[model samples]
Target chain A: MKRITIITGHYGSGKTEFSINYALDLMQQGKKTALVDLDIANVYFRSRERQAFLEEAGIEVHSNIYHSDISADLPAIAPSIRKVLENHTYHTVIDAGGNETGAMILNQFARHFLEEEHDMLYVVNANRPETRTLEGAMYHYHRICDESGLRISGLINNTHMLRETEAADVLKGYQLCHEISEKEGIPLIYSCCTEEILIKLKETDAMPVDFNPYRIRLYMRPSWLDR
Target chain B: MSEKQLMKGNEAFAEAAIRGGCRLYFGYPITPQNEIPEYMSRELDKVGGAFVQAESELAAVNMAYGGALTGKNVFLSSSSPGIALMQEGFSFMASAEIPMVILNVMRGGPGVGGIQPGQADYRQATRGGGNGDYHIPVYGPASIQETVNIIYDAVTLADRYRNPVIILADGMLGQMMEPIILPEARETVTEEEIRIQKPWALLGHQDKKERTVVKSLRLQPDDLENHNNKMHEKYIEMMEELPQYESYRLEDAEVVFVSFGSMSRIVREAMDHLAEQGIKAGMIRPISLWPFPNKAFDEISPKTKMVISAELSIGQMMDDVKCAVCGRFPVELLYRTGGMVPTPLEVVEKTKALLEVTK
Candidate 1:
């Protein structure tokens, strides 16, 4: 995570989860953090659901829809989004939804962070076919850049298979994304996985740097995991 | 369908649907089910069939009805909110007694809830989400293999009774990847068979027999009553002939747990835990949620003191459980709502607590 991190990826690539984890990590590091839920294209798993928990951790949170009513379906991006953009002092993570549907919304807020040093990170999941290769990852990356007019400064390897993800699987995604980052000239800022999987990489040489990546815990638990 | 492949659950169902002789698919994009259309658009096209991305679910179902009217096996799929929009078309299809297969990759909902799997559409699927006194035959499958088999079999069942069939699967079953042995593929419905069987097909009579009218409308009071009675008779036949359920370790166990779909798999785990602790527990899983599989209710163990309706919804299937039990035994509900799935240990703890209170 950086001064300002805008997270966007293909649908089911887990962008919101990445954004939530990055914001929490920044807060744990004793930095002022804020997560903006610019996910108007999707209703489920929006970052807004964790607002109270994030606020309890002493970080500000903004939702795309302000109404507590689920049926409201109004496109009210929190006014706080603009406020967060203006400040630039607090670590801000803007969570975008999947596909061009989600990236198009970022166009409105993309111009705000041009003056600041920002990293719009494309979270790539290798398990999905769309982001499995450089071409697949670039398809959405180019579209997000084209739609938002905001360049992706870095890439994050956030591979998963729901609860079935293993360390090897995450490593496979990291290798693929690392190449994409290198070819595209964007830095590979992080390779995220659950603390358990992350711990597996501790003794291995899978990571680019020993302690550079963030340890992410699974936040969205859909039914049928048998847990 | 044959040979095992580690395919995503949604793609498995789509492939199986095509093999089941489904020629046309009309659907809109929604999470947990996008793979169905994605796979269908690619594969169905290869089979010399068509996949049309409809403007809306409302349009999708109507397009399905139009396709099915021509006596071609048509398929359509959508998630909760999208399914909600297709209710009216479902009703009209039922009134006309048209044959079509629809898959509901269910999501959390009373409104725009979570994208995670939830069994909240139990009533909407079984009891009919659309208007009129109609019953949509719904199958709640627990596995990818079962999902493939059901999607394959559902097309024929829908055609057999000339009624719509809904494969009510959750997002977990749709999103998870699993190796499955596909069912033997069924040949595409031939035009000759359509002419002989579905004489009501809109594929022009060729001046041979009287032109047919395929519609739900019968303006006259007597005619409409006759149509309704005919549809009702088919539902009764479905209830009598199409009740399919599973009874697991249920012979002499106590505290029979009644569950369905993905929730039953977890309950099986909970049953294992109970057995390890010397608590004999069994399960009655209704594969077909509509007919309620009331027969499984009679198989409740003699040692059973409580019938637990464990599910992912806040007691949606419990209503049917209570009805089936009909006060003959104490029926308890153990459920988790809002896309939250309970673990096997959690279910065991809850069951033990309920058992203690009942004791």
Candidate 2:
């Protein structure tokens, strides 16, 4: 894993969930971590919603400039984010919003990203209408890259239909990501699978050797919402 | 069945509208629901549909009116304040007897309220926001899949009744993602189909038997009364045939909750928790707001003690719940307004207190 990791994907592609899990994973590894939410495109369900929870777990969280007003859709980026970007002591994960429009906010930090060792992982959920196909995934991948001025360093297959996820859904996303990795020559960094689905995959040894499995807990959605 | 696809509520609603044969959309961007217009602008053209980001909500609703006048399926979506601005257009469309579908991805309300999930527009949508004597059939979907279904069917419902239809979703629904099997796209209505079905439409008069005039100005009092009476007839028919709701565990219950849209989901979770604690709780989720689904109230068990309206706003839907209860039971309001959402635990706690007090 790189010192700085940037996660970007379609709106409902589980980037926020993955970013939260990734940040916690880094913290568990005894690394000082920070999660910066740069998702101004969405009005709700951003990583910032979990600020207090993440901070309680020893992970520094940064998000909208107006911290008090959670509902405000202001585009004002906090100046403190630049501090975390410059500090090499902490491993940082930047959770960009959905699509190229969401990733556009990252353009302001392009110089810092260029100077740092970062892995920009394009999360792909095959169940999303926009990224279900290789052509569709590539279109967004290229568009996000163009808008953010950052090339994707890896692909993450994080597909699921919320609680309805099955092994077939994960494998379908893996297939799409595999095709994209082969075509773009980008490494597939993670195959995010829920524990239950992972058990199902392991029953048949369906997962390939190269697919790095990343177990993700759905932190973005409340536990009460089964679907 | 086709593979289920994950989609945010806004984008899914937009896609469902397109598939529902809405070939023209006019909207102005606002928080939360902006994705509807964004999706429409990006995908509508590819499907041979037209999308216009109008100058304002008023302009967007007017554009929808203009498109619907030609007997084309038109879609319009906006948030709270934006919907408020489009009230005049809504009133005009209702008076003019135009058929179109409007989506209110509601947020905190009254003025330019916060950009968070809110159901304060319950009265605005179910009652009237514009001028006198109009009722738009409003469907409050609880989930993304339900939202898609309602939006898809709303296209036909609007056209069938020759009146505007409203799909009331909140920011939570607009931003949330869920798996949905989208219905097969409805074949777009051909020009010939339009001519045959909507003979009253104002297509070019050159080839028509009579010059068509679509206007709301019935200057004569009797004529206006007759026009209103005709429109009220459709509302009556909608009340009779279109009132839909879900009754969950109402067979034997001490307390019943009446909620709609996203708030109902939270209430459902609370019901489960209440059940664990030996508190018998039930729910009536109104899928249609305007028709009010008063029949569901009759299904409440005789054992039920009190009815509660749980909402994300300050007791807006409680009025309808009270009307439906009709003095048969005491109705109370449990709400979190100004962008605050009550957690399941909060709801459970409130229900317990309410039960104790009533006991």
Candidate 3:
């Protein structure tokens, strides 16, 4: 069965970037991968908008929109989803909209996995709305869980600054993940590290890392790179 | 086992947990059920187990999630409000088929009611207290011995089906101490055994084997329907496999008294009163409320005329009794909530009234 991975997070939590890069890496490794843009919250900067970038790299990119006029109604995309699950043999990466309002698309697709088709990852940035505090992140966790009928299997910490990202910020993100992993009962599966910086953040905690199949290539248990 | 012991319900639960071979307990202390965590803190070290008063109920339940995922005999304890906070994790445990035990030494609620014993949580416990379409097997023990036995069995049942099990007691059961026999300790699997047993549990997939993802996400309509159907099938199987009941002269009685947990003890005493009054009353106390003893009443309804359900809530389990009896027999409910424990005399009076109405 094709592995389905859902990437979701609070607003401005780098879910799109992570999803795009992860899908790119998976495809590069000869894994048949597809990226679905389910980001309904942010109108612009959606990974869906960069379909050409993915398709040109010999990958598949599907937008979450079914009808241009009725994009928000999740039921509209069910038939297309049914086709994909039935016909496609690709590593399906679902880039969910940020926050609770955007992740509502999950409910529409809920009927698809009667046999448990996918694993959900709740991407987090200690800096995002409703995720700044531990309590706030928990509330969002419950909200998505209650609404989507899906328990977050793992977490992705993309706590960083767009231009002024630092190693300290990355470590802070790991601390938050550590606290969440202890409390939520799910492991901190991985954190995204880009090629723009060196591995300056020490692995002070047990939460693992995902190198997004880029510059980092060592598949060590602590910081495993997909490539 | 000695005679009645002067112990609190929470302390009894803690002792019962130890007797049940519970090696890991994660909890955040709330009123009424705080003694459970306190006792665990004191006792876990002696048993070479681990206990943590988590940052919050959220963390405690999640830690329970990890422990359950690891397939260890684990438990998490809390009161009503705390259980409410852990509902999401509970649902996750249920769906993921994570086997673990939970003890809700219930206190009054509707949003932090009081630290008093209240059966008002009946709805939340019996129904889906957690989100989604799932049910957790619930066991209500009437006495401290029953608490020990049920906690032990909760662990067994949870692992047996790979689902979460809850022991729903009240403040009275948690705080009150009666004569109890601690069972002989059984061998439980270690963390290494856990890693060996469930290779699918997210223990950092170093095996380079096919990644076994344990998630409850069903995105397709047909697939979701199939999942629900499978869950229903398991529930049906549970109904056939796990229904338990205790009968007090039910074979020859005219009216059957239905109650559970602490309330059934009162009904037991009430049955004695009814016997002296020359009333043919028997009690049907359900030990497992979810896989409800539906068949028990089906077999008993033909022999009995009326069923009187005495509960702490208005009539949560009464509906189950009615459904179980196929709605052919008349079922009446008698209850007192908000930390009220009905006396034996009160139950006898209510049983008499129910008999009159059925007649």
Candidate 4:
């Protein structure tokens, strides 16, 4: 079973940062990694940069611009999708667009690939659109499942906003995602982690999956990091 | 391998669903297609599968939606009106990019028009029927064997593309019986294997690492435009790679006839009559409506003198043929409506008339 992890969330959610770090982490863990830019819907924290960087780090990348002024002229990327699924050997992580509309491109491209066996993970920032409340999150989930023809397998609570985010918000988002999980018939797979927040969230009940920063550390770590 | 047994087109679809790994069936009884759901109700239980006589076509499609959510190979059967009721759900299914098959045993349209066969819904099936710019891979099978084969292909294509696939057959195909050799079922990947492999699905977490979402809402114009561009890309990809059609005696022919579904059968008979009369003619049938072999018509336009499109509708496929020919050659339509099919004699007469006018 070749595993392809897709890291997605609403606009302004920290899905891109988490995606970059996660792909590098998997690579550090001795796995082949491929990161795809599925964010044709948003540009604030685009994934195309990660495409070149990931490739430089010996990871494959899929970045096709399907949304642009010359939109109708864009060649369909099914052949590329087929190639990636057929040839890949490592974990592939697609950084889908902000909303379901944007993410639908990936779903359309990989529709054949999303069978009963595939895993689709939704990144939830409690502050994001259509996900502020449990009911809102469930609405987004149902809509996404219906549009993409891909069943969502789990959720990743990544509630955050620049430096304004606190450990408490992550836990709150986790709980909200958990409530929505009952409606969607899936679970929150993991929660985003930060150094200060991880220590603060340690006492919290929501299980947080440690986002691997080792691969990024090998290339370029954040200015604040002391390795 | 016993000899191919004669079976109704609807029964062929039912049997094909079983052979194609469709383990779940959800449908409400409708005229012409009732036998399909009835057959499924009886056989699904014996095969350790799930079958539900949904409260209505609306419920049936949604239940199939539930079955599809479970990553099960699922199917739903309905007639024209019932299919109309399923449009809302189909739009959702199309937007979600779920891979499933829908068997539309088409009857007359607008309301509960008639129990008789009609291709009037050709426009509705090819065009997006619900709110949203969505498309389903539509296949019009002309025979019982094609009914089974198209169902088999529809499931595989839907699963392969992760989009809903429609098997568009009229009441003639659904109610009529013919001999067919059913194919053996192929081994498919299990849902658990899919769960393990495609980590983007909405399955509950096995290992908590990050949250994933599935959505299609793009609030901004640029964002939405980009999403639409992506869909166009998918359509182009299907056009170039998956255009499905069958052409007979097209080479070195002066007159070419275009038809689909049951009308194609009549076209074939007409072509045969033309052949016996020593009047050179050919025929082309489109099995897939979305990818619509427009390029095929374009390729042969220069060589052909006259092209006639015969359909069960006023002229649904004529739009496609006209678009393809681009007035490179003379294009004409031989159409019938109100659920009544034109016979081979009628089609032959139209073909002769077209040839005379153009030549």
Candidate 5:
């Protein structure tokens, strides 16, 4: 794992959820962690909405420049993001917006990323309409790289249908990610699975032996929503 | 049916519209519902459909009107204030009996409210925002899947009645993600088929030697009255045939709650918590806001002591709830306005407090 981990994917691809989980995991491992939200395209369900909760858990959250109302969807980027990028002691996670348009904001910070030891991971959810196939996945993967001016270091298969995800779904996503990795020469870094789905996958022994799995919580969705 | 896939609500509505045979979409971008137009611009062309981002909400609605006048299925979507701007066009379409589908992914507002989820447009949608005494059939879906299903069917429903149909969703519904099995695509109707099916359509006058004039203006007072009566008859038929609602845990419920769209989903969770405490609470979720499903209220358990209207707006939907209850039970309002959403625990606590007072 590199000091700076950048997460990008299609809208509703679980990038925000994965970024939060990855940042917390680093914090739990006794590293100083900071999560920066660079999503200006979406007005709702961004990682910044959980700022107080994340800050309470000892993970510094840097988002809107004004630090205004969370509901205010301004395009301003916070300057503190630069501070986190400059500091070497902290393990930083950048949650970029969805698609090429969302990742376009990263171009402003391209120089810093180029100079630093960083890993840009493209999250893939096969259930999303845009990335269901190898061609579709490759299209988005290339578009994000082109727009962000940053090459993707690896792919993370985080496929799901929210709470309806089964072991078959994760395995199906793995197949797609494997094909992408084989075709592009990029590594399959992680296969994210919810705790329940992870247990099911283990019981069936469906995942590959070398498969790297990341556990995530659905923090964006409220508990009241059953599915 | 295709396999279930996760989709954001706005994108799902756009996909469902295309699958329902809508070949024309005209809309301006507005948050939380911007994905509708964004998806249409990218994907509509692949399916032999056309998408136009009009200069303003005013232009978007008129463009949809012109498109629908040609007998093509037309779709439009906007947020609260944008929908307000399109009211005049809606009135014209309603009076002209134009078939089209409109979506209101509402946000907080009397003016330019915050860009968060809100149901403040309930009165504007259910009642008339446009001039004249016209009522458009309004469908309030609680989930993304339900929104898709309603949008799919609304395309045909609009054509059948020759009136614009509205799908009422809040910012929460437009922004949330859920698993949905999309409906199969409908065969694109040929131009020749449309000409035959919609004889009143203004395609071209050269072939028939007669022109179809689509307008809302009636010069004579009697003529306007007759036209108004005809529209009223159609609304009566809608009330009789199109009212839809879901009654959850109503059997022997001591307190009944009424809500719709995103707010109802939160109220549902509150009901479960109340049940755990040995409190028998139930809900009447109105899926159709226009032909407001008053029938659902009749089935409320006689033991129900009070009826509460839970909403993201301050007592907007309560007016309709009061009419539905018809003084059979005491009615109350529980709400948070201007983009503030009441949590399930808040609803649970409110229900208990009301129950205590009634007891």
Candidate 6:
């Protein structure tokens, strides 16, 4: 297991959703885990939105990160985050913000984690406006690295369009991510989809997809959607 | 024609702009349209052009205004909220009678709405978003291929009237991929060519003529009024040119769907499904939403008894559709707002229900 994993992507790319579930996935794999919210760019749909649920599941949660306060736009790096990463025994998963504006906050504290073994997972929702094409996806990747002073270690394909997402949508996203992963020489850390899609994939292999895809439950939703 | 390559709408917009002799590009990041600036930055560098990812949409539009004064065809793209921020600059460009090509890859909104395809900006685009007595000739292309062609003409059209022109597309078109035959690259407009063509362009007085000024501010009320009247005359000339719209299967139809942009493409699918069910229907797609091809309504078959405004918004474009029909036919609205697209089946069902009730 990676010592520390940072998840970042374009705004509304569903990085926060992937971050929350990824921490749970770590816990399920029998690893001591802690989730950290370093998102300061977006005011809604941060990893902290589910802090209560995460804590209830016996996972440690770090909230109010990046100098957070009632004023939502300012960037302030919290020093306690380094303490969590230093706890060698536990795996730390930090959910970075939507784009460069959010990921740039890490530049302030890059020194503490520079030597530590960490994987910067660039989460991409192929359907989102920012990652609709290869050039667009590459631009965001470069911007995040330029801002945070960190290199992306892997690519996570988590393309979706909320409840309207379909099997075809899943395949479209996988195709782009698969090509990018090959060209960039980065690992495709499993394409993400709901369990329903997995069942569909099993019935017929119309388009080719790399194995080792992760099944995800939809956790990123507005409160009005919850029944 | 070059072999068709699979291209996203935003990428096609950039490629089309570059081929149209647009060198100076000013843009900011916004969803559904970020690919535009991303493509421009990489591709423009190769063409010896300048591409600045401005800090904000406000700054980007202003930069575009300055670039236009230099007599180069300038390009800029933004989504709904970001376009809202650039309204002031657009107004300035219109008043100065400067030529510019702008693209608004619209998303759902009144404010910072969802990053999904929306046509709520119909009024914003056609009626003019900026504060002014001006109308920005807005072209609404429904497909990726059409986006390329329209952007090609939009540049010339902007120069023809010395006014700002907008390619008003939506989020779906921006993100969707389609095989499009790229147009032949046009020769870039050189400094010498601009100097000769645009006599009023603000290239410093090289001891040949008096200094040229490009300013929107007119201190005297009479001067501003005269300028506004001149703009109205240009608009009259634009209207006389005869706007474009696609009439699909309008003959022998009893109902017609009025729509544009990505929504119009979806409506075409719905029309096909309606045909499959033996429900004869037609479509009137407004290519230029600003000039609004209202004359198409006169071409509707006498058998046409109803019109449905199939839009991506809650009946915003319905206003124009109403005027087009002029109460000759009952017009109903079939729409979904805030990132939810109108499905083909939903539209087919909605049209059938409206037909049944009206009958």
Give the winner by DockQ.
Answer: 5
Please provide, for model 1 over B170-198, each residue's C-alpha lDDT reduced to its tens digit, 9 standing for 90 to 100. Answer: 98788766546778877777889998888
Fnat of every candidate, listed in order: 0.08, 0.84, 0.00, 0.00, 0.84, 0.00
Root-mean-square deviation of each candidate, in angstroms?
A: 5.1, 1.5, 24.5, 26.1, 1.2, 7.9
User: lDDT by residue for model 6 over B189-256, one digit each (tens)?
Assistant: 88899888998788887886566888888889999899899889999988868388989889989889
Provide DockQ values for all models, in the order shown.
Answer: 0.10, 0.76, 0.01, 0.01, 0.77, 0.05
Give one digit per residue, the lDDT tens place, for model 3 in B37-76. 8678988888788898889999999988886665567878
Please, what is the whole-model Cα lDDT of each candidate in the order they appear? Answer: 0.82, 0.89, 0.72, 0.71, 0.90, 0.81
Which candidate number would show the highest lDDT if scored against the true structure?
5
Kindly list the per-residue Cα lDDT of model 5 for residues A88-165, writing each as its tens digit: 888999999999999999999887785458999999999988889999999999999999988998999999988789
Q: Model 3 Cα displacement at A173 (Å)?
A: 58
Worst 10 residues of 4 chain A by lDDT: A218-227
Comparing 4 and 5 on TM-score, the stronger one: 5
Off by over 4 Å in 5: none
Error of 5 at A132 (Å): 0.6
What lDDT tens digits, residue by residue, belong to model 2 across residues B1-359? 35688888888999999999999999899998988998899998998889998899888999989989989899899999999999999999999889989999988876897888898988888888889799899999999889988999999989888889999999989988888888889988888899899987877877556678888998899999998898888888888998899899998889999988888888989998999999899999999888889999999887789999998878888888998999899898899987788899999999888888988
Compared with the true structure, what per-residue lDDT tens digits does model 5 show for residues B6-35? 899999999999999999999998888999
DockQ of 3: 0.01
Between candidates 1 and 2, name the one with more favorable DockQ. 2
Candidate 5 docking quality: incorrect, acceptable, medium or high: medium
Docking class of 2: medium
The TM-scores, chain A only, for the candidates as listed are: 0.90, 0.97, 0.80, 0.78, 0.96, 0.90
Model 6: what TM-score? 0.66
TM-score of chain B of each: 0.97, 0.98, 0.91, 0.91, 0.98, 0.97
| Model 4 / residue B30 / CA error / Å | 0.7
**Residue pairs with backbone overlap in model 2:** none
Q: Model 6 over residues A18-60: C-alpha lDDT tens digits?
A: 8888899888898888888887655444566577788887678
